[model samples]
Target: MTKLMIVEDDEKIRDELRLFFERYGYVVACATQFDHVVDEVLSAKPDILLLDINLPYYDGFYICRSIRKQSKMGIIIVTSRNAEMDELMSMNLGADDFVTKPFNTQILLARVASLAGRVRQDGVQTSVLNYGNFSLDANKMLLICGERSCELSKNEYRIAACLLRERGKIVTREQLMDDLWNNHQFLDDNTLTVNVNRLRRKMSEIHAEPSIQTKRGVGYRL
Candidate 1:
């Protein structure tokens, strides 16, 4: 069974979460020591973390950053902070997913399952999708060519994979957004653009060629 850690301060809500996940066959654990959350998480070594932003000693953002520096465990922010900035900040800080409070548990479960399926031990995925010299290893979220390599974030990886797969073929914005949404990314048009731009920058950083090209009023292609 997957081990799930809940880093929420509210006892009532925390209990509710534990019960819900327990019903779904997860080995759930709660962080009682708010001040030592980082150490507790490191010790427990849960497969996934349900984090709340408003914490006692250290907030979710701090704990997220701290844990990310040490582990690759998936993190999903489950908090009442609904601002776009909060979601963006959480992702920027290495959270794999973000869900606001009053969330549908079923949807949250789906996200957790999806992330769980992607994560594995180090060097687990050896397969790579290639285009001439450039290649993408979905497992590591890495884009590589020769000796140069650049790590990709979740959204950036999705966008790059799509474009790389359809390298010479044009992909519309609607198509890209729909694929990301289907994958539990929940990205908007503007957000897709931002992700694409970031992907381009990462590709440039490694000097991987056959850059993703804009299709004027249509869409984008490699």
Candidate 2:
């Protein structure tokens, strides 16, 4: 069964959603304390997250960004904010999907199921890899942080994925260049630097600094 985490603060809505999802064969865990949301999320390690924009203490975006630091799980923002900017911002923050308030329960269920399926399919190779506020999907080349996600280009994905897989461990620059380029022996060093910068920018977009710390004389580490 797919496990889901519900991060809504409204007691009535949370209960309804929990009951509704449970009926759909999902194992649902609803947040009881806003302050401990992160701890709860890490412990639950849910397959998908149902987030409300208006959360207690810290807003949903902060929580999403925080989780994005180390999880590639599906994230769906179900909120009352209906503005286009709100939707855009949610996506930018790392949400896989956005459903406004007063949504159809069936539709919400369907979206959750769809996302859950994708996450499961991709889970085969992407068992785990963590960055600051982002996680890399080794199989899908997907960069996820909170409600925002960015699809990585082949080289970009490989480089970032490599760093994340060996997070906290150094990966030499030469090794990274070779891994990313494969048989391409003529790839420029400057080109590698450029790709790294672009990947760094993408990571920073969702509030995660590049966990890719340079060793100056060595390589990079997440």
Candidate 3:
């Protein structure tokens, strides 16, 4: 079943959304705490996130940016802030879509369904990827090797996922950066190198076999 997470502070609206989405057959999870909204959403590992802009501790923009750093989960900003700049900022922070306040529940449902469909089309709906002895848990951001396991950060998980998808084939640096940042023009090459190094360290800690191999100027291989 497709999972949905809601991060709205308004109790009445949150309950309404949860109930409405559940009626549509979605396994819904609601945020009970506002200060750790990002962690809450990540833990839920929902297929789609319905986020509100005016959160309690941190705004939705901050939450969106934090979530984008680790996962490419679909995020739709459902907020009362209807200004054009607000929408633009939400998109800039990696929100998949934006819906204004007083939104029609049906419309919200349609948007969630559309975003979830896009995620499926991207071939990321699966929660796990198995490569040889390694099992990458997309939901938990964990890489398991036999009995030992190591948790991965969002960037590390993406890098591992990309490499594992192609297995022994070479994955160029440019391809990795594009995959990680969604072709953000301002991204630095060093960031990709750092993430790859971190991933290598994690894999090593678990003694994962068929280690990530650097192909010098060409790219990396597993």
Candidate 4:
């Protein structure tokens, strides 16, 4: 089920939205504590946020910035203030969409559906991985160093994707095993080691500075 958080202060509007969306088969939550919007958001870990620009203490923009810092969750500004500047500012603050007050509930729901679908669909359409003068296409798993293109194997690509997603953070071997094999039988340690070595060799060809780094007993990072 898609989880949604409504961060508006008006009790009537909040309850209305909660009931309406819930009727449409969505798991809906409304914010009761205005002061702890960020805390509520993190705790809920909602898939999409319906936020109001005007609020007590900090406004939606502040909450939006805070959310972006920690997560890539979808944000939609559903506010009474409908100025062009407001829309632009909301986008700048990382909102996925904007819906003015007195909106058609059907249209708003449709927009939410479309945005959610896009977010889910975008997981595989990887952007180019660029570090220094080297770059690689993550979805196609093609590495480019200057004019050179290096091909990566299936296992190599999976490992690279995992490392690239975490980037500078350590990705434990257990995590890699889960990612590569789901919940299937355990893969041989030698198999993983061989794939990592192959990945490193390909990365070297692309002049990937630092390539993949091993943290001894910890894991790997890039």
Candidate 5:
């Protein structure tokens, strides 16, 4: 099922859209905090975004450009601003489409469906996990910190991917082992330790600060 995120600040419109999309079998997430729109959207990892131009802190144009820098997710500018310049600006900032306020619900749904299809067709890999100043490209097995990037070994990539996906949260040693060895068999603890140390060293080579922290008896957190 496609996941959709609504970034409108109006509570009424946000709720209505959430319910409408939920009824249609789309997994929906609404932005509760306007200040960190990009972080919220990235954390949700939605397939499409229904964004409003008038927002607190930063406008939708700024948010769209910021997201575009790291992701190619579908963005539809749903705003009250009907100016031609607004639409053109949205397109220039990588928005897939623009729909003015008081839009036809059916037409909006159709646009989202169409854009989602195109995004999938393009095979745009937007599964990057951003933690602090680092972005982990799981698909390419690359750990990117600013302009520097280091390729990861298969085991190192899997471990880093897991930790970054659950950034700031504890990923249990048992869970890490399970992810490393998919057959349900336990691997030596020292092997997992070695792989993690190697990933840390690679991260240091690129000057990625605040290295992965170990939770000792628990697990690890990035």
Candidate 6:
């Protein structure tokens, strides 16, 4: 079972998340106390952390930076602050994922499971997927080709995995969005394009930049 720590300040939302994750068989813990949260979290040693930006005592960014420095535990920012700066700051501070408030818990659960499932308690590589000349280590979120390698963000990893899964086939935009951004309901095309382009740049580091080819009006192919 994956141990998850909830750091929300909202009593109702915190309880809601606790009940929801518990029903799914997760070992859930909530940071009910605002003070000394860092020490408590370090001691509890949960596998994943659901952090909120508007925390008492200290904010989520501070907690995220503090925890990341001491532990490699997965950190997902669950906050009401949906600004682009907030998201960028969260990622910059070493958060593994970010989800704004008013989000569907189901989608949040999926994201948690997807990230935590990659590495076990022992921190070993869980799986490596190979397609043509390149290999993607899902556990490490790394794309490799020949002697070069590049680390991928969660979304980029998903995009790469989907593309490589359908190597020769053209994966339509809708299909990619469904598999990659199902949580977003309908992700903007420009956002998807931005992500795809970013993935391409990362893949380029491994000399596999051309592996992901755009399909004019369709979607993408690997």
lDDT of each: 0.82, 0.76, 0.82, 0.76, 0.82, 0.81
Clashes of each: 0, 10, 0, 0, 0, 0
TM-score per candidate, chains pooled: 0.56, 0.55, 0.56, 0.55, 0.55, 0.57
Q: Per-residue lDDT tens digits of candidate 1, residues 1-222?
A: 467899999999999989987765567999887878899998998888999999998899999999998888889999999999999999999999999989887667667755655554232422355553477877688998778998999999888877755656799998899889999998988898898999999888888877889988889987
Clashing pairs in 1: none
lDDT of 1: 0.82
Tens digits of lDDT, candidate 3, 132-178 = 45677778989988789998877888888888666657999988878
Candidate 2, number of clashes: 10
Q: Which one wins on TM-score?
A: 6
lDDT of 2 by residue, 1-222 (tens): 467899998899999999987764567898999888877887888888999989878888888888777788889999999999988988888889999999998778767755754563234422434434555665677787767888888878878766654555688888888776674533467887888888888887766655567788787776
lDDT of model 5, residue 5: 92
List residue ranges in candidate 1 displaced over 4 A. Answer: 121-222
Model 4 stretches with alpha carbons more than 4 Å out: 120-222
Clashing pairs in 3: none
lDDT of 6 by residue, 121-169 (tens): 3354335555445667776889887688888888788888777556557
Give per-residue CA lDDT, model 5, range 1-222, as digits (tens): 567899999999999999987765577899989888899988887888999999999999999999888777899999999999999999999999999989998778767755654463135644454555566675787988778999998888888877755655689988999987884434579888898899999999998755889887988887
Candidate 3 wrong stretches, greater than 4 Å: 120-123, 126-222
Pairs of residues clashing in candidate 4: none
Model 1 worst lDDT window (10 residues): 120-129
Q: Lowest lDDT 10-mer window, candidate 5?
A: 117-126
- Model 4 lDDT vs. the true structure? 0.76
Across 78-124, the per-residue lDDT of candidate 4 in tens digits comes to 99998999999999989999999998987777666555544432233
